[model samples]
Structures are given as C-alpha cells and as structure tokens.
Target: MANPVLLNNIDHKDLHVQTGRGAMFGDNVMSALTFPSEFRDIQACYPIVFRKADDGNFEAHALFGFQEGENLFLGMHGWEAPYVPLTIERQPFLIGTNGTELMVHVDLENPRISSSDGERVFLPHGGTTEYLERVNSTLLAIHQGLQQSRGFMAALLEYHLLESFAFDIELDDGSQYRLAGFYTINEERLSALAGAVLERLNRAGYLQPIYMVIAAMSNFRTLIERKNRVHAAQC
Candidate 1:
C-alpha cells in the first residue's frame, strides 16, 4: 500500500530520496508501463509490447525480462541498459490532482525515501532541490505522456493494428520459457492500410511511434542474450 501525501517543503523539508538503482528499491520487474513519447529511447534498449490492463484497456509496456519479477536490465552495478524507462525512474513519487491543478505526491512508505542519506528533497533554505525539480519534470512528463497514449491507442484499435504474440525461448541448458499475453503491432495490417489512412495516422503523430514499436522487437535478441548470460552464470 502507498502512503501518498501531497508534498510540501514544510513537513518534508529534511526528506531524502535514494536515487540508486537496485531491487531493494523495487527495480525488479518484468516490464514497466510506457508511452509513445518515450518509445524511441525505449526501443533502443527494450522491447515495447502491449498488454490488456485489468480495466480491459490496452497499455504499452517496455519489456525488461521474460519472467515475472525478473528484470534482466538490472544488475549489481546498476541498470545495464542504455536507457531506463521514465516509469522506472519515477519512483516514490506520483502525480495527483487538486481540482484543476496537478500536484506532486510522495509515497512515504517507498523504499527510496530516506532522512539522513541520498538526494535531499529540499535545500537548506526550504526550497526544492535539483533532484526534486527533475522529479517534478518526470512526473509532469508522465502525466502528459499518459494522456497522449489514450489517443494513440484509440488510433491503433481503429486500424486493427494490434496482434497477440507468443514467444518460445530455449536456453543453452535446454530450459524452455514461453512468454505469452502480449500484443504487438501487426506489420502486415499496417502495410495493408490505404494511403489516406496512413496519412491520417501520420498526421495524428502516431506513425513514428508505430514504427518505433516495430523496431523495438529486435531487442528481443538482446533480452535473450542477457537471459542466457544470467543462466550461464547461475550454472
């Protein structure tokens, strides 16, 4: 459970946030919620896929590992990937709303929260610190990016571009793993669309993200390699 409170420099003046990456800080995960805005960066390091949320809405995710609670990108030194998804970076904090105004809220119980060490939330004079400013930016970006995803998903559904996929992996030791319950953009369906439809999608700023998602599929090989390395080391 989250103990979220509207952040204020007064009550939380001495608070600190540990910015290091590790499972202790809750980095272990198979995937993170992603949005079209970061698809380019996400595609470079992780495979972007879609999954149906409990609410029955499709949500985009940047795949980090094949198994549940397994994040191949995370290591003892830190995250191995060239880019960490913004969703992963924004920890211990989330956006809230006060009527028409957006507000920043901190999860008091999050492991990243500290009092004596790590990045300070407020400066000595009771103003936000650089770390807090970046957090604010990250939160705002997430807020806007999620809003953008609604229309992007609507466009995908309109064009029937999403298709379910299953991946079967065989490790060096002959261990087999099956990744299911994920969706990807159907290239065939996308290619078959009429030019006017394509133009409409492009005009709506959804085309590049579509291509980015397609490009991200290539990173599955990287993911497999990482898994194999982990398996080999375990032997």
Candidate 2:
C-alpha cells in the first residue's frame, strides 16, 4: 500500500496554494500548453517568494521554449510568467512546440532579505529550490527516455493520458480541494474542471500508483506523435 495514499481526498497541508506571486508552473506539453490562459495585466503583479537566497550566487532566467506560441519565462522563483517578448512585441512568449523540455539553471546571482523576514536573505535558492530540483530531475528523466529503457513506457502510454479518458476527483473527510488547473482558467470554470477530475478519480478511493498517471501525462502527445508522425530518422 502506498504510504501517502494516492486518492481523491489528498491532504492539502503540503499542496502549495498558488497566490502572492509565488512558485511558477509548467506543463508536460509537446505542442503547446493545452488551453492557455488569457493574462492581460502582466507588467504588473511582480514576483514574490518566501525563500531567502544567500549572496554571491548567480541566477539565470530560463523558460521551457515553444516553437509556435510564446516561450513562458521562468524567473522570479520559477514562476511561469509572460512579458513583452524580447524578439517580438506583437507576439507573446512562444512556448516551443514539441519541447524536448527545458533545464533552467540558477547560479544564485545575489541574495537579499525579503521584507517579511530579515534573517534569511533571498538568494537564487529558496523554498522553491527543493521543488525546482525535483522538477529538473523529472525533466531530465523524460529527456533521457529512461522510461523506455526501463521497459514501462509501452503500457504506461495507454493508461493515464488521452483526453478521451476523463477523471473524477472525490475528496474524503470533507477535505477541500481547490482546483486551479493552469493559471489561465477562470474562477468558475477552473473549479468545475478540477471537481470533475477529482470526482472521476476519487470514485475508487485510491490509485494503485499515481506516478504512472503523471508519467502518462508527460509522455502523452510525444509518444502518440512519435507513433503517428512520419520522420526521416530510422525507427
């Protein structure tokens, strides 16, 4: 039995609530972020993070690039953000189509204390370092095609992905699950969609392994695309 229990009623104590301009987000996208959000006032809402970084370290701003759409910038605590494009003003950041994935490097440029807490200077590293590290590792694993090497890729491709298969999430013990699927979703609609996924998934009360589902989402379009797309490269 999985210790944490992968089910509808997941405990939210650790689940990060995105507000106050904290941690950025990215999607396991090949083509583009499915259903991109319409963010109008961006030059506003500066990035805010709780983690204080140490001095003498450099940080680099990188985003998982896309070919057709705008590349969402990863800066200010890995928050996937939008800005007036450096290359094109009319066009927003282009999230590279069929991204192999991006590995944003943070060298810890400088450190300073956030207004809230003075003891800890905000360096390139903060509370997000741990989560960002994990994200980086997963992106690396996907890029290396390690799953195929491990022999789990074939079966996994079929189970958790494909929009044809929808999910219902059910939260137990009256636990509140506020769904914010990608920043683009509206208040009423985002709630509805999350409720639906949770309800469909929670019906069973538990998942044998949740990681498999995550794996499927990450590889969904890529696997299908590879199978369908005619390429010059030999199989």
Candidate 3:
C-alpha cells in the first residue's frame, strides 16, 4: 500500500529522493503504465502494448521483461535503456487533485525517501529545488497525458483497432516462456480502414503514435537478447 500525502515545503523541507535505479527501490517490474503522449520515447527502448485496467478500460504499457517482477533493463550500473519511461522515472511521487486543482503528493513509504544524500527537494530558504521542479513538471505531464489517452483509447475501441496477442518466447538455452494478456494495434484492420477514417485519426494526432507502437514491436528482439544474457549469467 502507498502512504501518499500532499507535498508541502513545511512538512517535506528536509526531504531528499534517491534517483538511482534498482530493484530495492521497486524497479523490478515487468511493465510500467505509459501514455500515448510518451509512445515515441518509450518505443525507442520498450515495446509499447495495451492491457485492460482494473476498470475494464484499455491502458498502454511499456514492456520491460517477459515475466512478472522481472525488469531486464535494470542492471548493476542502473537501467540499461537509453530512455526511461516517465512513469518509472516519477518514483515516490504522484499527482493528486484538490478540487479542480492538481497537486503533488509523495509516498512516505517508498524506499527512495532519504533524509541524507540524493537530490534535495527544497532549498535552504524553503523554495523548491531544481529536482523538485522537474518532478512537478513530470507529474503534470503524466496527469495531462493520461487525460489525453482516454480519448485516444476511445477512438481505438470505436474503430476496433485493438486485438489480444500472445507470444511464445524461446531463449538461447532452449527455455520457453509464454507472454500473454496484452493487446496491440491490429494492422490488418488499420490498413483496411477507409481513407476518411485514417484522415480522422491523423487529424486527431493519433496516427504518429499508432506508427510508433508498430515500430516498437522490433524491440522484442532486443528484450529477448537481454533476457538471454541474464539467463546465461544465471546458468
């Protein structure tokens, strides 16, 4: 469970956050919830896929490993990927709503919270530090991006562009694993759409992200390679 509280300069003036990537800080996860607005950057290193949320609505995610609690991107030096999804980057912090106004909230139980070392959250005079400012921006982006994704997902469902998929992954050591319960863009359906429909998607600024998700499929090979390397080391 998370213990989230509204972040204030008075209560959190001495707070510091450990920004390094590690399983100890809860980075050992197979996937992270992502938004369409970040598909481009996420596609560069992760395979973007969709899954049904608890509310039975489709939500996007960036794949990191084949199995639960496994994150291939995490290593001794930190995350090996060129880009880290903002969802993963924003740790111990989340957006909260005070009526119609959005506010920053921090999890008190997260291991990243530190009183000494790491990035400081406030200055000596009680103003926000550069790191805290960046976190604020990240939280705002996540909030707005998720809001935008609601429309994007509705459009996909209206067009019947999402399909369930499963992958049978074979490792170099002859081990096999099944990856399932994920959804992806149906290219055949997308190609078969009428020109006017494509125009609507394009005009709505969803075409680029659609293509980005397609491009990100190529990263599965990279993910397998990382898994193979880890398997070899373990053997």
Better of 2 and 3 by lDDT: 3
Whose TM-score is higher: candidate 2's or candidate 3's? 3
TM-score of 3: 0.99
lDDT of 2 by residue, 106-196 (tens): 2121121123322221223234434334434544433343223222212222233212222222323332222121111122432344565
Stretches off by above 4 angstroms in model 3 are none
lDDT of each: 0.95, 0.25, 0.94
What is candidate 2's TM-score against the reference? 0.17
Q: Ten residues in a row with the worst lDDT in model 1?
A: 73-82
Extract clashing residue pairs from model 3.
none
Note the clash tally of each candidate: 0, 38, 0
Question: What CA root-mean-square deviation does each model show from the true structure?
Answer: 0.7, 21.5, 0.7
Tens-digit per-residue lDDT, 128-187, candidate 3: 999998999999899999999998999999999999999889998899999999999999
Per-candidate TM vs. native? 0.98, 0.17, 0.99
Angstrom error at residue 75, model 1: 1.2
- Which portions of model 1 show Cα errors greater than 4 Å? none
